[model samples]
Target: MDLSDKQQRPVPQGPRIDRTFFRQNKKINKINKLKNKIILVRVLTEILLGALRIVHKRNTRAP
Candidate 1:
């Protein structure tokens, strides 16, 4: 009886904790994805700007 009660008690609580944990994990994953996307955009913009600067310098020097 004691073992059965212990098992039953944990079973209900286990799923509850897991549900909350999964919800939190999903939120965190979404935030991480957004951050990564922002970082990627910033890096790409920097590279493009640098390339443009180099091209402009060459064009000006040629003339």
Candidate 2:
């Protein structure tokens, strides 16, 4: 019985650790996705603003 208990103890512990690790990994993935989205938005806005500036310059020079 003692040997059986010892063997069974490790089995449950293994899955418990895996579950917590999986949860942590999920959280990290979500945060990374959000960060990537924010960076993409910032880059797009910068490009749009630069284009607007260029257009404004051209219009002013033409007039």
Q: lDDT for every model?
A: 0.65, 0.66
Which pairs of residues clash in candidate 1, taking residues 3 or more apart in a chain or in different chains?
A: none
Score residue 21 of candidate 2 by CA lDDT. 60
Error of 2 at 44 (Å): 0.4
Name the best candidate (by TM-score): 2
Query: Any runs in candidate 1 off by more than 4 Å, and if so which?
Result: 1-16
Worst 10 residues of 1 by lDDT: 1-10
TM-scores for the candidates? 0.69, 0.69
Clash count, candidate 2:
0
